[model samples]
Target: MTDAFVAALPKAELHVHLEGTLEPEMLFALAARNHVELPWPDVEQARAAYTFTGLEHFLPLLFRAASVLRTRQDFYDLARSYLTRAAADGVRRAEMFLGVQTFLDAGTPIGDQLDAVLAAISDARTDLGIDGALIVTSQRHRTQAAALEVLELIEPWRDRLLGIGLGAAERGNPPAKFADYYATARARGYRTTIHAGEDGPPEYVREALDICRADRIDHGVAASADPDLMARLGDEAVPLTVCPLSNVALRVVPSMAAHPLPAMMAAGLLVTVNSDDPPYLGGYVNDNYQAVHTDLGLDRPALADLARNSFRASFDDPHRIAAHLAAVDAHVRANQPPERAYRAASAAR
Candidate 1:
């Protein structure tokens, strides 16, 4: 589709972290309200600090920014703000990741945070027309028991919460570390996804599938290094939520132009573009789309496929998925001049 059409097509985000969307302004405001001290006194300094050598460098700052979220209202406002922006970006359905372990580390009550965020999601759906679901994520750096504690805490809100995920540093702590927790979550009927092969190796992705039983893999970029694993992902049709800006910012890849998104797509993997931590990573969902399209030289049909895969990989109801896919198809058919499509794609790049 044309760049404008791609930007306008209704969509769903299956892999965004609620904490990661904390913009600098929101962070300062929340810190002031909660009486928390921030290392950066101004937004510019905070923005500068977003430049990272890797995920390890980014995690401490992410955790520190999260410290300002002390009250239920803080959580509610954070979620509502993101949902509002997502709606404006043409996201009709979103399944957001909530890093409860961060809150728990800061001494905030898990139940309070979940109640507040879930309440705001419900309100946003009614008022803003944005349908959202929560995915409570476990920090892979922590013990499996800690992950299980998060699952139990979220048990009451099971219907509103969509799934369980393993996020955070994916280096030493492989998916095997959280196998039992994911197993329990799966047995309880929760959907599963995990962070693997982003900074970790292809073996990590395998463990996520074989041990943790994850139905989806987030940032499985390193799968390209293993032909067997890549083939398995394509054959199984497991979706990979690839975040272009996040990868570039964290130096997981040298640059956006060098990203493996197109290759993964060509391999028949259900690759979906996402913004892992948009504000912090310097872009949102559409910005990610634009960056990858520009950098990887994606055409109209390839761009359409990415948009289509987004909804297809989402946990939204089948009817909603069909409706959004119809919108994408209509946009593609209406904007099919190959030359103009190429020019528009180049400009977007």
Candidate 2:
């Protein structure tokens, strides 16, 4: 698709973090509002500090950004801002990840955070026409009991929450570490996904599938390294919410051009692109799509397929998913070149 068409196509985002969407300007503003002091004196300095050697290196700053968000209005504002931007980018639906551990650690009640965030999402949907849901993500570094506690807190809002997710540092704490929590979530009838194979190895992806019973794999880039895993993923048609910019920013991959997305697609894996941590990674969904298209040379059809997979991979209701997919299909068809015109153009070339 042309740039304009790509930009206009209705899309869904399955792997974005609400806290990570905290832009530097908003961070400072919220910090000041809460009477909290930030480590960076200015926006540029805060932007500079976003550079990270790894996920662990980034967590401190990530937590610091969360520190400023102390009240219900703060969470509401954060969700509203993200939803507004997402709607502007043609996002018809979004399943946003919100890490609760940091807020809980800071002494904020989990119920208050959930209520405020959900309230903001509800308001944004009404005002902005953006359909979205929340995913309460548990930190991998924390114990399974901690994750279970989060699930308990989320139980009341289960209808609104898409599901529970495993996030944060993924290196040593494999999916197996949270097997019981995930199983409990599944037994409770919650949809599940986990972060694996971005910083961790392919084995982690396997564990996420087998042990944690993940329905989707987030950042399953390293699955390309293992032929068995790749085949299994393809056979299962498991969706991978690949975040190209997040990989580059976290140094999981050397650069955007070298991202494994193209390779994963070529291997017949179900791959979808996303902006995992948009603000920290330097862009949002459209920026990520453009980067992958330019750097990886993804063709228009492939790009449309990625867009389709985004909705398919999402946890939105079936009726809503159908509507979004129909929109994407309509956009693709309307924007497609005529067959005869394409033939003539090819002959002329």
- Cα lDDT, all candidates: 0.88, 0.88
Shift of residue 250 alpha carbon in model 2, Å: 0.9
Candidate 1, 108-219: lDDT as tens digits: 8987799998999999999998889998898988899989988888888887788989899989998998878988999899998999999999999999889888888999
Question: Evaluated with TM-score, which candidate comes out highest?
Answer: 2
Candidate RMSDs in Å, in order, are 4.3, 3.0
lDDT of 2 by residue, 1-349 (tens): 3278668878888999998999999999998898999888999999888888888998878888889988888888899999999998889988899999899888888887999988988898899999889888999998999999988888888877778899998888999999999989999888899999989999999999998889989999999889999999999999999999889999989998878788788888889888998989858999888888888888778888899899888877789888888898878777777994587568879
**For model 1, where is the 10-residue window of minimal lDDT?**
1-10
Q: TM-score of every model?
A: 0.94, 0.95
lDDT at 38 for candidate 2?
A: 86
- Residue ranges of candidate 1 with Cα displaced over 4 Å: 1-3, 337-349
